[model samples]
Target: MSSAKRILLTTISASPRENVNYQFNNQVAIASQAPVALIKLLPIHELPDKVIILCTQKLYDEQYETVRNLLLEYYDQILCNTLNQRPDVTEVRIPDGRTVEELWQILEAVLHSIPHNCELTLDVTHGYRSFPFLYFTAALFLKALRGVQIKAVYYAMLESEETEKPIIDLSLLLDMVEWFYATRIFHHTGQASPLCELLRPLETPPAGVTGKDNAPYQLVKSIRRALENVSAAYAQALPLELGREAEQLLRRITQPIPRHMEQKVPLATELFGSISSFAGSFALPATRQRRIRIKEVELNLSELTRQSSIIDSYLKQGYVNYALGMIREWMVSCAMWNQMAEESIYRVDWWIGHKRFETEHKFAVLARTAYKADGNTTRDIITPEQRWLASKWQFFSDKRNQLAHHGFRYEYVLHSPQQIDEIRAQWEELKSFVSSKPHWNLEIKRGQGTLLLSPLGLSKGLLFSALHHIRPDEVFVVTSEESAISIEEITNRADWSGRKYVYKMKEPFTGFAEAKTISRELQNYILKSDRIIANITGGTTAMQYVIQQVTQDLRLTGIETEIIAIVDRRTPAEQVETPYVPGEIIYIEGQGRLNPPPND
Candidate 1:
């Protein structure tokens, strides 16, 4: 822990007006003597452990001793003649500050002279022309690098014609600078805690702030709530909530402010003016977009645009993980918007329709598989342009998964020599993506989801082929005691990210296995998906017969079933050499309890 002290930093100048009636007019007790020099006023008021006077060559020769003698006289004459107890006064010589290099030298001198974590106060009353800007830059650096707390910044306006000059306190500007940083953090990283702290500087509002009569307090609280709500909504990637909060925040920000707010909170109207501009640019009109109602989803062009802007802001700030996660969702939302028809879909009808989550899930499936799948294979649900877009997002999804999970399941470090380059390409494409409206000629019709059930055996490629080809939503594996290792083998090579169910039949090859017992065990697990794909390509004859019986039992409950076999096209030698590769899928139809008969 580094220690800190109350230190005042000021500059000396050889101004001709030395003796004048300098009455301290402000409410703050900054100076003890009414007629003290502007540079010495802070030293007299604070009586810090140390006082630093920055001066140039001529000022040091002419004006430095006069200021030093006044400080000594304060202790010797005014305070019972005790001169030894005066604060340590040090003179730091700086350049003339005529050139940029000289300005840097002056800043470096002040920075090095100041200790770490000091309650710092700066007197900008007199210095070279460049000293004020250079001093402020140094203060910013010290606050960040050295933990310096800027207590006050004083400026005496000698330009006034009267003998009494007013000392203006410019420390309020420093607090406003914090507001700029708060808004920037909110925009870039979707964070708002800094704004929260600034809004309520004290633990509670000062004294009499109880009810609606205190309009300023109520308004301030409203402003804080609105801003924080919008920031949090963006952080959670909730588009609906973000739009609602942003639009509401905009309405409050644009409301008329009380004229006397500036008297209580300094720069009150000006403060809200800045916030108005910020909120208007980022979050206004979010919920005001014309919502088009299709079958089950309502699409808002403006809301989607706002969401894209948030993602772009996060990406520009190098929050790559946040951007990646939102892009996948943004794609799904765009697909829903693209489902509009010429006359079938109602335009600008804000009333939300049915099956939103279900339709969105189906649309996501369509967007992911529609592009690569043949039009016939997809039942013409996926468009050619959609396939092109999905192809662009191929590795981005995988990359997002890797980042989200921190690659815990990976065998090696999740990296590739060409990975960053590929991501750079993806970034460029995504930039173009957010800049434009999502376009897909998708007619969102609910499609039957796939479910793959198989038995584990000597060959793992059979299950791998069915999973890759079918891309099931739910999976079930029938494994025996001996074939438990076979499940691990298949999963190690197969990238199947879906919910799965497994059963351990003790004797997989036993002919004495009871059909009633197997069906009862299978029936205990309720079937949600209507379509079932039973890959009877692995396991022994007994296991195969048991799975067949289970599929027949599932049909009685109205679940559609497809019994399939994988016939390896490769010969025994080739199959042994490349066992992980796929073969051909033979689909055999099995009826389930009437599921609307597929057509009507």
Candidate 2:
């Protein structure tokens, strides 16, 4: 909400060039409203009011008299052009090896000589390394000229083939400038500036939600522009150098032919084989090597031309292939690290319970069971209980996919490091939630037999187990499916000894009427009997059809009864048919009882 305190205008040059004219004009256009100050190592006959002529000690000694005359003429021109509002132009020089702080001290001395009414406008483009110098100088100037507004201009080339571009670490810059400035408006000549092209607006925030005012968009754009310029310059200057380096490497490997060599054909064939082996080892295409040699080498009528050219081409192609492979490998490593960091920051442990644990446990148990069942000598690394826990955990796969694949785009921001940290914290909170809850322990005794329960099938099992701990009763099962042996088989087993159980199968019906009649009769038996156990098996057709008829008959008679589904395994089943409307049951096992006595 703070107002902008200053504006900056700058033009830069290493030496005189055609690009300077465009830079001068662009600065003028951008700074039309603000007072403009030009800084140049050159002394000119004519100058603007706020111009500061900077001369090194070497320049002052070499052209002292001539520079003084030019400075006088420039001062006269500025005085004559504006009758009342004349610009303050000053010429100053500092000794060699002076620190930036010392140079600023001399610059400040010259600025103090000017009238109090004149505001200082710094044109940074013409100075050495103007971008960085101006950035630092502006901070000091703002500190010194407490109330006075300082407008500084900075100009940089989009591409410069003559010199290597300066590498600016933007993150470090962000930290320095974060509090110093209120607002920064960036301008780019679209055609001439790489900064313009690289900084085009994006559709949305790259990582997390971003406000319109965040600094990353601006900083990232600046970095991309700087990198593009560096890359373009490197590409322009380095190809020939790279080719020469490749040729030297080839010469080292192939140039010295032995004086006693007589097996020309065998040697040439062996050279080809060696080249082929190297190419295959590096995963380079034979055809690519052929093309590179054709492009880089000159074939002549010499005796060794054919052999040398082939070897030269292979060496060049090998370099290219190796470089590409390294780049790909680095990119993959970077991407993996980025993913790991994201996962860590997002605290994506919701998947730990849901899917991550499930899949790993399932695989571990399956491997263990498979190994054990196969009668292998390997140790049992995982147990059946582990397998069941894994199955429950596997349900998290969908949740994991939701968190990993789409969570950033839909619900979160990926780019904001702070937000990522917050998300991770939330994930930790969720983990704590899970850790606080009690877990069911499944134990199988040699003679007691095995019991399987899960999030899907174990609700009733949990309640029933708790009930059995308090009061013992013989269990029975009524099921829709016809089995050769029923729940009675387990009840009558040696483990159970003489435990009582009754298993009843519902008769198969062809129509809804017959099915409803059988369901009513089953409901009557359920109400009249002391304890009833049911097996819900097959798909939706059987389960829904039976449940529908039973619920309808129970509602019509207003009879309260408890129905528990006991099953060996669980699978997803669809609702195939609609059930008749019925009042809610007092107890629906596996789901939970509707109401129970406080004592019970």
Judging by TM-score against the true structure, name the best candidate.
1
In the range 341-425, model 1's lDDT, one tens digit per residue, is 5463445432233333433444444444554354354545445555656565555677777777876864553556476556657
What lDDT score is found at residue 165 in candidate 2? 24
lDDT string, candidate 2, 232-346, tens digits? 3223323322333333233322433332221211243344234323222212112335344333322111212222232233223332222222222222222222233333533
TM for candidate 2 is 0.24
TM-scores of all candidate predictions against the true structure? 0.62, 0.24
- Cα lDDT for residue 71, model 1? 64
List candidate 1 segments past 4 Å from native: 1-4, 26-45, 76-85, 172-178, 184-189, 202-205, 208-213, 258-303, 336-386, 389-393, 407-600
